[model samples]
Target: MRISFSKREHDLLERIRSGDEKAMERIYNEYRNEFIGWGVENHSISEQDALDHYQDTITIFFEKVMNGTLQEIESSVKTYLFGIGKNRILQQFQKENTRLRHEEGVHEHYRFLAEKELNDIYTSAIEKTAGMFSLLGEKCKEILKLFYFDKKSMTEIASVMNFKSEGVARTSKKRCLEKIREEMTKERNGG
Candidate 1:
């Protein structure tokens, strides 16, 4: 790609323009480690990715010089290299984020299916219990509904049902639960 090499840093620019391998090597050696370190600390980019990015940055720098796209080096070589590293690091992060989002969406789909299956199991169990509960006496049904379904306290059930005391309400609820348990057991055991 065409780049306008700036004239401000002509010495290094001229070296690069002449296809001087030493000049390129010097730049690579000078900043490669520093760039990689920065990549690790700031961007969390892998070492290999950092290496590849740095090389691409250098390549772009030379292309800018050779093609005369860069009229001058408006910024220092180090600054330009660092800018390229930052851009490449950002690209890596964006790609990683996109991948994670896709995985999360797939997991969400599976999780939704799992939760729906569990809910269906619970709903079936409730329906079965409701069918059996229909056989309970009116008093038993009222006590169970007030205590369990409505989440009423023993004292509240005693007040509503006009039980002699909270103890009576508790006793009645316990007896009703025991009867339901017996029926459930008999049904399951096919007695």
Candidate 2:
């Protein structure tokens, strides 16, 4: 059964949904510090990580409200913020688990299972990364997929991506790698 919200909490959520900056500020001010403390004490997240998670939770909450998915303020705003923070912390743990599993070699049986799981995770991550490339208005996704996934050389990718020269393609590929690294860091840091 869903918990019931206080009248004031419901009103605050409504104001927040309506894009009231004051209401948003009130909610953030009410919960940010306690959520950060909880993240650190319970989840072992670093101070910076806690801060980032708190901000992300607030952002997600606002997005949910705006998207009309946050239909009922069935709990205290503090409870909702804590719930978001908990989920974000757990997501970080899952990503770390996936990374660690990849780093540590496993037995054949485990390896097969890990490979399958990793492929599923990697495919989803790459699709999201590809979407970002689409937003950049460049052929970065195709070039990167061919170079990395297809294991093609710069010259080959240049031919495919229609770069003027292999040198230009190499430079572009290097820049793309840097961008991917940045994206990976963002993902790791729960951004």
Candidate 3:
């Protein structure tokens, strides 16, 4: 049995889309207990672990909604949140072999939503990396994007970037990546 969002859910989803903080709080409050309960009860995950997973799920949920990956819900927002929670719990179960009980086709409905989320993750990753890479010099950006984003061969990159040979292109790309890494480290360390 499918469950679509009610009118109130539609309004809340719209507010979330509009970046309303109270809307976010409302959704967080609505699902906090139920999601944590499932993780703690079914998987025996610690409360802290459950809280961490819930936070990550919320991030992914916001990413899906804000980035336009989620549209025209086939189920209630509550159901969708549970589906994300279930996936997170399963990841833990795989490692520790924690308590997991399931019946046939139980998770089928959530598959579409989860798969849609996976598809968005790649694009979102690219956008995120692209943003960070933009902080580099233009030459570094071009070289790195050519090698990583465009997937151009070293030989091709050498020819395009006017490097003497594939060896030179490879060295240049390495140095460019190192510079980006150093910048990222400094940023993370609050340099």
Best by lDDT: 2
| Residue-level lDDT tens digits of model 2 in 1-191 | 67877888888878886679999999888887888888899988898989888987898788777556677766777788788889778977334544345335433445654567775655556555656766544677667756754567888888877899999998887787678667767877899
In model 3, the clashing pairs are none
What are the candidates' C-alpha RMSDs?
Answer: 27.7, 13.4, 13.4
By lDDT: ranked, best first: 2, 3, 1
Task: Kindly list the per-residue Cα lDDT of model 1 for residues 1-191, writing each as its tens digit.
Answer: 44444454567677876678888787778899998888777877788777877887777677766656664544677887798768767766334544346446655776653577665644444545578788888999989977765567999899999999999999999998787767656766898
lDDT of 2 at 172: 86
Q: For residues 52-135, what per-residue lDDT tens digits would candidate 3 score against the true structure?
A: 888878877876665456766789887888888788788663344221232113235446534556646433444445667767
lDDT of 3: 0.74
Estimate the lDDT of model 1. Answer: 0.73
Model 1 misplaced regions, further than 4 Å: 1-9, 93-191
TM-score, model 2 to reference = 0.48
Q: lDDT per model, in order?
A: 0.73, 0.75, 0.74
Rank by TM-score, descending? 3, 2, 1
